[model samples]
Target: MSMLNAMRQKSAKAERSCVAPGEAGCDPVSDEANGPRRDTESTGSGLLQAVLTRENLRQAWKRVKANKGAAGVDGLDIDQTARHLVTAWPTIRDQLLLGTYRPKPVRRVTIPKPDGGERELGIPTVTDRLIQQALLQVLQPILDPTFSEHSYGFRPGRRAHDAILAAQGYIQSGRRIVVDVDLEKFFDRVNHDILIDRLRKRIDDAGIIRLIRAYLNSGILRDGVVLERYQGTPQGGPLSPLLANVLLDEVDKVLEQHGHCFARYADDCNVYVRSRKAGERVMALLRKCYGKLRLKVNEAKSAVASVTGRKFLGYSFWFAKEGVKRRVANKPMATFKQRVRQLTRRSGGRSMAEVIERLKPYLLGWKAYFGLAQTPGVWRTLDEWLRHRLRAIQLKHWKRGSTIYRELANLGATEHVAKRVAGNSHCWWRNSNGDIKRVLTIAYFDKLGVPRLS
Candidate 1:
């Protein structure tokens, strides 16, 4: 049978299984063995208990509309989903509450990873997206307080900077021995059964549990082949980050219980200790905990060393004469330069202004994070390189001596000087810094809205 027909048959079987014996409606207890009730208060704290309300669904719909992506397996785009939800959300909400809603099979697409390999990303249908958002709205508040302050990944109002600051604080206080732990294929390796078992301890509603189970079991299509994914949550799915965070909360708890000072942003964990011996002991315990949790430590990436010898979350920590110092790690800084080159390259076929516009947000955000470190000299160097890149892009756009000369004259260069500069036998970089820099001053580009690091 074709994929579509197969999916339809599978969905029908699932729906049939959801109906309890001797009952006329869908059963929330169809898989009661997998779900168990817990003591949860039915007040403002019980968001999951009141999750299926129309207002909640509308809020979820709004989040879906704001997210950018293509249509999923159901082929419904954001606009189409929004229009349909306007008229059909009440019914959808009712179905979800009744535990009769079946999520569509996830549409899988392979995306290029940073290491030149491809990773599979599962895209959920618009309806599933709405459900995931609603679930997140309810679960976020309940889960947030339980997570450690060290966990900055995927949490609202927290960031890598927060993680770095915590680590820096430890180092400045004389605890310099650090163990950096990296998880191997973390999202792809989380066991669904373990995740659900842990989640059950905190959540009570059977309907929500059923929905999460269905979401996890949803089929994934990769290269026209249907695959049963019995493990990790889909990386691109809306709820994956939250679920991953939940799965690792135990690690945080275990470390805290053992009195290890650590900071974690998702899979990246750094444990601070008083000395090398203490660091080694902490690393051993961390490995033990990870092993018990069925998680693999990328031994090649994990390291137990001094704070000055390790990099965490793209920032390198070192002990300076003044105090602890943090800077953008060398590798990450190089990567940033490569990305800037890629964005500003003439071969991209974008106009100079367009390239600068595209580069602004990335540059601005990077600067904001790195600005925490004392790097005025580094910023000036980068600013110069960026200007040279912009000049090369403009030269590519001008394309000829006459166009270059005219543009130079337009930017306030004398006719003779403009002509002489345009006819020079220098390379793009040389020409840019030589005569072009005089005409298109830094202030000129500043007025034109190009971003600066200095």
Candidate 2:
């Protein structure tokens, strides 16, 4: 996974290459049709052949109009990765991609704990497994060679999931304290002026900042607009993550000054400390650093909890019962059916049953989150993709009894609420008589979309 983190740009070309005569064996038909023939122009020198291939080779080209995600940065190729390499480090680039090159030896260092503690930490070598797993799940569509660049993480969805899992793992180990720092708008809210200044502080390379500025100004947007100014790119731009990562690399200095006791990727950050006071001290230093950089923390959505159930990224972190759970509400009969149909279409004609099967893992977690007390089938249309592909059709009669029954039971008024409402009566919970009460109400709405409560 760490190797994946180091791999910033992905190549667009499919993994296709010529097979040798015996190793993978070339195609028999092609081999038989075009047998090797001596060329009078070819020389015996290997260097001569290399020069000829480099100069004479006419690379294959594809039409941008006929393909999806063709309008890449600068209209070179859909793959900007190769170009980025050539521009950034031409010598290293040529040796890596076009010629043979050996990687530098891994560097190591020793570190210490924050809070003026006595513990010393040794910096270990970066491993590939962490990045492999993270990017494998984050970029799952990459498994399909046909997938386009647009399918990449345009938002902080998968990254957030990874962060939550990392935090949850620590909590599950019986750690008594945990503090998660939430940077308010780490992307858009980031101060570019401060970032540029910080970048200069970290690396004396002005060219890198120039490159970053170019990326920021002319990047792509989902609404199909090219950035006309430094900050014109939409929040979902492809270069946003890359640029944000480079900027946050400066934050590592402050982290090291305070202590690099936690792990992070992009804006999804988790600061782990051994003790509660130590955690608070780290948070204080972080707050000071952000203040110095003209950044503020969003404390409302950001929380510090020893026992909380929240979904970080895709991993579920549960201390007690407050972990994050994915949810879907049942729509009206007419609208619900339409939604199921739409979901199926969006999932590439996946059948309803097959869709459900794919969603079972997430849906099962949702069921647990909802405190299943009534409905037997919680996520009825969870697998609409598979269901639609399979041509499975079923009309479900959704009962509103689930919420009413559960709320009443939870409020400890099952007997009282049942007594007040007659047979076939519908009710919702409300605060009445100095206690939770089930107020009779109808689930359906009139033309105004307002429910009638009685």
Candidate 3:
């Protein structure tokens, strides 16, 4: 038989053999002629019961269509899977319901980091990705409420800014010390057995549990060759973030039980206390809890210091003349400047308009984020620096005094003024603040689609 005929035959068999509701066991495949096996009974409040619904499958298919990732170990891209999903959904859904669906091995790709190193990223097969999306839709509501308010990370309607704001509130309320904790290789360090064991307490469906276990165990790293990954969840898998948050729920509970004031954004945690003694107590408790959970702490990055002295989620809390103030940290600002310079570099061989077009998104996003903090001075300084860089780029683009003079004249500069400005100096900084500065005003740059911090 052809592949389509074979799949249709299998699906038809599965549907006919599927156990009905109120059966002893919900197992799709069972030896019992009368009903399903007792162990497979669906008695829990878990949302996996809705997995096989056509609506849920459609939703899953929509998510797959929206993704922009590459093909997985199965060598099927989103477009290819989409083309086959209409024909494939029946068998896939039947196998999922029967607890017989096996996920393909995860494809690992290494991404280059800023410091010239690489990080492993796992991509799941298109089918598995669809299943993961469906699972997320079902599980998110159940798991979202269990997450702590101070923990932000991947949760919807929460962000690093929220974490910073929460920490700032505590600091304003007289929390003196802030203990920052960094988890060492947090995603890669999760123990699969422990994660599954904990998951069993909340979820009771065997099919769902089996699916999760398969996802956890299906990771395969190939660096020009297949490599072994003995433990921990895959970092880049669709389900990894949810699993990591679920696993860390225990840590949140432990901190709450000890009455520790804390804010967590994924593996980055900041514990606030009234004094050094309280900070020490919280830090010790955290160490014990982490030890019990087999999580490693990066001691070098972790520190218990004054709230004014530490930075969390790229924002720093400090006492100013008015009150406690929140502002962007030095490191992130420096990095932002470096990125802007790199993107707007004169020698990059891109046109001035092209460079500005590329920088619009980055500039807008960075400004929107840091704008949350009260930093008008910082914004003004950055705006001046950026305008100067643009001026330098424009000068480099002009390349010749004749071109510069013509450009200045075109911008309505008087001929004499343009000649003087163009002949002033070859130095970009001097020229940017001199004649070119007048010709290319902030309004002029704005007209050319250059984003400015205000």
Best by TM-score: 3
The C-alpha RMSD of each candidate to the native structure, in angstroms, is 6.4, 18.8, 4.7
Residue 65 CA displacement from its true place in model 3, Å: 3.3
Count clashing residue pairs per candidate.
Answer: 0, 32, 0
What is candidate 1's lDDT per residue for 323-374, written digit by digit as tens? 8888878877887888888898878899977897899998887787777766
Stretches off by above 4 angstroms in model 3 are 1-17, 20-46, 110-120
lDDT per model, in order?
Answer: 0.75, 0.36, 0.75
Instruction: List the lowest-lDDT window of 10 residues for candidate 1.
Output: 36-45
TM-scores for every candidate against the unseen true structure? 0.85, 0.39, 0.88
Residue 78's lDDT within candidate 2 is 34
lDDT of 1: 0.75
Candidate 2: Cα lDDT at 345: 49
Report the number of backbone clashes for model 3: 0
Model 3 residue 167 CA deviation (Å) reads: 0.3
Backbone clash tally for model 2?
32
- In model 2, which regions exceed 4 Å deviation? 1-165, 201-208, 218-238, 257-260, 274-277, 319-454
What would the per-residue lDDT of candidate 3 be over residues 187-248, giving only the tens digit for each residue?
77888678877787877665566678767766484765555555677766667888888888
